[model samples]
Target: MKAHRLLTVAVLVAATACGISPTDVQDRGNAPTTRIPPPSKTIYLLKDGRLVLEPADVDNDTVGSLLGALFDASTKPLGERDTALRGFTYIGIKDSLNPIQRDEVQLPRTSTLTVYIRGEGTLTDLGKAQIVCTAQQDAAFEQVRIVRENEDRPSRTEGRYTCGELK
Candidate 1:
């Protein structure tokens, strides 16, 4: 009985001697939650005459959809940055046949992404950079071709460009 009593006292003293003070439960607000982010694509915009890569929210990841988002004014540039793709409209992809003559032209492979646009005058180098970089965001596409559509026959090829060459 003496040994049992001494053991009980020792346990009590040891429990209280440990410098930990008991406190009430803490209410740290609600539990943490996790959510998946919306879909987004990388696009190139211009800042002070230089190319700046930016993320843009989009409903689809298609080249046309991505370019459409790039051209959208609502997708404002961050800070004092600007977009070279402004004032340019994206046209549908070129088909295998020439629209005028109905002659079969070489179809573009998956590695080549073509961007057709209808705009007045020529596009500046920065503007070309924006289109080329945005369209070639996927590594699957090795090159990007910009074709200018006009009322006349034989559309002008702006030139085939690679993101590496432009950047």
Candidate 2:
């Protein structure tokens, strides 16, 4: 019993001797923040003449991956909904000066994403809406500019558009 009391006293002294002091909680300002990723991938397709957001089974939410999925005929939702992306072929994401030569392209955290495409036919406003809305599904990309490149003519800007503007 004496030894137990002595050990308890020694523990108490050692704990108190440490530099740490009991104090009230400090107000250290706001906590750090983080961007939460979306629960599922989404792509824009046309329901009748209007744009509609549809859940996609795409592997990643990258601009290229989403565009690729948007263009893929097999993945198109059945019934009235159809893809306007068929009017143009998805080339790649336009970098600072040139298009990225890859199958998948991930945009920077927050920036405008420019996508290069070769229009198989005359790209209508609906086509532009499809491309713009589909690309903008990734929150990192605030706006999308569709650049149409033709073999016989110089590339032309279809106009920068946001999902809200098109849809």
Candidate 3:
């Protein structure tokens, strides 16, 4: 009986030293009292005829990975159709018309990033517009120049563009 009383006093002393009351210890058995919101990142998407800013709860903030997700064909925006708006592709090789299927292409950290498109196809002008605007959103790329794979020079359709003009 004496040892039990001493143990209780020791526990009370330890709790007081830790700045936690015995009542607080008991209350801990209750459900969690605080909830922290998950971290999120802001990314742009094309909807209708404009780029829309949306917050996504992504794991990390790697620019390449974020670009990949933004370009992913399966990612659907809220209140939108299941299909992706930007289906444009490019062929980096000179004179080759092969289409690069992925949504994103990461260029070396440069002031101007050149995006080469397949010279001819059903690729719409809207897709090209989205590509230019989306790439320029990155801080590393201040200007985006779209060109054809086989063309030596940038055509009127293929030239330097800024996000401001498109978005």
Candidate 4:
């Protein structure tokens, strides 16, 4: 169980650090083979083994160690819910403008699942983002970007499709 937790952490680290995987150049379902609508919420993809948060790409906030670790597992099967938090972690805040965020709970072998939760309903300078997750495999990522929804905060995005934008 501890190892599983550790691996979960590893995935979170990988997500925030380098996105999710190498093949996901664009967001999932945005494939050339299968055409999908452009996502209103710009989420970071783990393509080519890297982390990316769009419409913008950068990490300028101070990530709390405990929060980072908590975020690492929040999308999985751990961490707090819509409570309230701040910092630089894959987990961001949700507000009235952008009240939704999603995270992927990676399950070995099986398909990935997405968890969707509402954010704090407001954006403060502290990066008090809303959006939490539940471990649900094979489910589609949410339809909210952590920041794009609110131009004020661009890094904020969600969806199980997100590897880890907390970067």
Who is ahead in TM-score, 1 or 4? 1
TM-score per candidate, chains pooled: 0.61, 0.64, 0.43, 0.17
Candidate 1 pairs with clashing backbones = none
lDDT of 4 at 33: 75
Residue lDDT tens for model 3, 9-108: 9998887899654544355477868854322255565567566666544566643444445455434445652223344444331221233344686444
Model 2 misplacement above 4 A: 1-39, 74-77, 95-110
Q: What does candidate 1's lDDT look like per residue over 71-133, in tens digits?
A: 774245467778766667778653232223225665545456778987776688888888888
Which lDDT tens digits does candidate 4 get at residues 46-163? 3333332322121322222222433443344312222233322343332222233346543333333222223445533113222322111113333223432433553333433222
- For each candidate, the alpha-carbon lDDT, in order, equals 0.74, 0.76, 0.54, 0.33
- Poorest stretch of ten by lDDT in candidate 2: 94-103
Global CA lDDT computed for model 1: 0.74
Q: Model 2 over residues 109-138: C-alpha lDDT tens digits?
A: 446789988876777788888888777666
Clashes counted in candidate 3 amount to 0
Better of 3 and 4 by TM-score: 3
What's the C-alpha lDDT at position 36 in model 4? 51
At residue 149, give the lDDT of candidate 4.
41
Scanning candidate 3 in windows of ten residues, the lowest lDDT window is 91-100
Sort all candidates by TM-score, best to worst: 2, 1, 3, 4
Candidate 4 yields a Cα-based lDDT of 0.33
Order of candidates by lDDT, top first?
2, 1, 3, 4
In model 4, state the lDDT of residue 104: 59
